[model samples]
Target: MNDDTVTATPAAPAAEPESMPAPEQPAATGPGTPDPADPATPGSRRLLRAGAATAAAALVGVAIGIGIIKTQYDDPAPATAAAPSTAPTPTASATPYGAKSNGSHFGSLRDLLLPVPAGYRPGPDDGVYGNDTELNGEQLSAELDAELQQIPKDKRDKLRSYWEGLHVKATGVRTYLSTGDDLVIGLKLRQFNQQEVQRINEYTAVFTGDTGLFRIGPSIPGHPEAHCYLMPAPPSAPIDYLECSAAEGDLLVIMNAEGVAPLPKDKIVALFTLQLDRLARPGASA
Candidate 1:
């Protein structure tokens, strides 16, 4: 489950125009002309010749001028009348599950897609992981696990099953789990899910130091509605894990760790809450 191992679906390419030949021009005419039926007098013939020559010359001059104009201002080929630039049709931003919003502002996958959990409180660290920010994998996991342990064991197992189904694997132990309405927010939950899997694999490589196949489990208590993964760090370093979910009106997020330097419990709770707030905002889905 290394990050590099995760691949995204490719997008389509734009279309191109085909080449074609140019049109032929018409023959030029003179001012004066002689009847061919009559073997015209020399004078008349001369006049006719002169007229034809003049007409040809004039036509050439006009063609040259037109070429110049085309080169300077006009498009060479019949210009494609520009299609009216219709404004992009706006999509409805609000959904029954939540509101639409951007995920970029929030650091973690959970924050980017869902609203903060209700009755949530930070343990101690306010700015560290609590306020819309990132907590190291180890710290986040430890805090999350401690919270999830508070839930009934059966509930925890149900949550774990959900995550296991997704085959989520990281390099650490999970510490916390929480849920919110993400589908309604119009978040690119599918893309987020893919990225989460990739991130778990990446962290696994970082923790193990040596490259190897890592298997992630599914749902856990705190993230009952979402999927989870684990990747234990090397003995010398802290483990790292991540959990994410995108269900009808719910989003579940989880973090884990099992070593020194675990993320503060308060910050972990706060981070989840902030994510939910963003998801609940209007226009977030767009």
Candidate 2:
């Protein structure tokens, strides 16, 4: 039984030898082989990884540098010098009656630029009232109207109509009786007229009687010639005279203030005459 078994087993084919893994060979080193510790080495995985990391770090560094450069060069700071002050300039003060108040008569017309009349005591009214007359302002105006009534009917009618149109309300009428020292002075303010205004400006006087005749040339710098005359007064007062005339535009003005005591009649007449003469001189046209 042993012989048969041995023959049949043909000697279990010689046992196949188990193959062992070839011993690991050292990696081949070419001309550019890298060392694992060196980042610049080629063909070394550790070196390639380190190099990639270093390149990435360098790119990041460049970006940070560019940002810093831009920040430093782009925007500038604002100027810090102190700002200038802003203040208003001062102006000059204006003078009184100089281009401010147009010519206004605060007192008697004559008082504005001439010597005050002698014995001319101030009246209760701001305007001068004659001290020589018993008649107050109202009575003087009435007497003036009575005197005007003596004009020719047609002329009186025309004059009355004109005065009515003017809305004239007589303010005062008084006579200054001549007291040898002064001529009688009378003044009446009824209404304003352009012609009478012009005449007044020219200093022209109009008289209604024989002794009143006189010529007054322009006394002002520029004005037209003016004429004066004496008109009859009420018989009761022979020395009293009515000086009536047309002003600027048929404006009737009558002067009847009489001069007495310290004022001469001739002097009063001459004073008025001189005043009118001044007016007759040319004045600068309005």
The global C-alpha lDDT for each of the candidates, from Candidate 1 onward, is 0.26, 0.26
Best by TM-score: 2
Model 2 gets an lDDT of: 0.26
What tens digits encode model 1's per-residue C-alpha lDDT throughout 128-172? 122223333344335435544644565335433333333222211
**Which window of ten consecutive residues has the lowest lDDT sum in model 2?**
1-10
TM-score of each model, in listed order = 0.23, 0.30
Error of 2 at 3 (Å): 99
Worst 10 residues of 1 by lDDT: 4-13
The list of candidate 1 runs beyond 4 A from truth reads 1-223, 238-243, 248-260, 273-286
Candidate 1 scores a C-alpha RMSD against the true structure in Å of 32.9
Candidate 1 TM-score, true structure as reference:
0.23
